[model samples]
Target: AENNRRKKLLRSAQKSIMLWDPDGPARKPPRESAELLVSADAMFGLSDSFQRCTSPDFLLHTIGGTTRGAIERAYDWLIPIISRLPDTISRLPPSTSCFLLLRAYGADGERRAQLKELSTPLLHHVQDSLRGTLGEAES
Candidate 1:
């Protein structure tokens, strides 16, 4: 039952990350784009939950060793959205950043290096944002 639950959660995460509207004659409104960004953030949070609920080996197996690729693809999808909303990247919850780092750590050297390259800026952004927030609270 637990395994089934984990599998279901992983599938759901994959589906969320894969959600994208293809370009059409009519462009989506700004609000729809904003909603996509919000959904991506929620998906990241959900991915973090998956990281916490299962062992690294189990997760890799469950996702058919495609977790890294999925994460990278999600990052690609998110960057444009983030560029439009500069503050959005920094506002990502710590769990999302932590999970990315943790997965990087567990990966083989090539994937580890790739994930680190992708996550470094994000980690720094989150750190800076937290510091700024705390500083404001003290003022």
Candidate 2:
């Protein structure tokens, strides 16, 4: 039952991160201080568990959601934890996490240089993992 509960929580976290529309009716930042405050708390709380998840799929999904949120200007809530990504990425073994991290790194050249540098090992791992499956094309 604990596993089921964790999965549910993970799903909820992903949904929250991915579905936060900055342009929504009342979701505008700075002015919407209350909601943004609550969201920031939740994001920090979930980030602790994000590091503990054993499944690569869940890690990829959570990181992807967070990256999407950041790109979409969910900075009010995600800014605090964004700095910790390099540490998180350092601990995780190279896997599907590379795919999403690469996407995040590509979004802003100046802002995400750390992600670009940190993704080096993951990029190599992904390259080796997919070497023969689709030929040498570095998608």
Candidate 3:
């Protein structure tokens, strides 16, 4: 529910960002307020989403519908965008920026593995327990 809302907001904001034209010659130094706002909004949103999903409470509760499968889906969706974000920002060379993205990717993969180690076993246990319970129900 919350995720669906957030995703919609992100798409609308990005669309608005596209509508702004900063490079038009008539523009002054203040520059492209709509696009800048959208970008800032987007960066804030990504930061917030990442923080929320990775927090200890989120790990325990498995909130945000971020199952192992959903997280894998998010990784597939975000990897290219995350890789491009630093390059898109232009504060550093792409080569140096690559290291930051790679490091993040490595750490994230490790954490996901740790989560799966716990989540998968617990899920299997629950399923097995259910099967056993149902078996006895018939006898």
Candidate 4:
């Protein structure tokens, strides 16, 4: 059931992009493709797989250093997933959301700032829970 839903989401995103920009994937610049993907994800709903694809490990170890084409493809997937991250995280269960945000906050100040800037109210709740748990765990 979940797999079927994911396939449908991908198809919806693809169909929308084809209508919006027929040659976008092949001809347009990568940033433009990223924008299309972001719009598509927003319109159709975010894909968990697509969000995972944007992770630095996936980009660096899996997609990076293979070829120009591969890196370009990675960049195409990366930007928009990152752009929609706050929304994505907000939709996750509290524990998972808190883990991701805490990881991001520890890694880069800029990312922490972005999370602060773009976070939904749900995300704030998760953060608060994470803070509460942190103190409990330390005791």
Worst 10-residue lDDT window, candidate 3: 86-95
Task: Write the residue-wise lDDT of candidate 3 on 1-139 in tens digits.
Answer: 9788766655655543333265654332233454465467677874445434524433223213424444444444333433434222122222222333343435556544443433333344334444675425433
> For this target, which candidate reaches the highest TM-score against the unseen true structure?
2
lDDT of 2: 0.48
Could you tell me the lDDT of residue 97 within candidate 3? Answer: 28
Instruction: List the global CA lDDT of all models.
Output: 0.50, 0.48, 0.40, 0.50
> Candidate 3: where are CA atoms >4 Å away?
1-37, 41-63, 77-139
lDDT of 1 by residue, 55-100 (tens): 4433333333324465454553344433444344444444444456
Ranking the candidates on TM-score from highest down gives 2, 1, 4, 3
Model 4 per-residue lDDT tens digits across residues 33-125: 656676676677655554455354442453445354553454434334545654443333354444444544554566555545544544675
lDDT of 1: 0.50
> How many residue pairs of model 3 clash at the backbone?
0
TM-score for each predicted model, relative to the true structure = 0.31, 0.34, 0.20, 0.28
Residue-pair clashes per candidate: 0, 0, 0, 0
lDDT of 2 by residue, 1-139 (tens): 9778655655554445333555774333332443454456576875466554656644444345434443344332332343455444433333334544565566576446544554565565556645644324434
Residue pairs that clash (backbone atoms under 3 angstroms), model 2:
none
Pairs in steric clash, model 1: none
Which is the better candidate, 2 or 3, if ranked by lDDT? 2
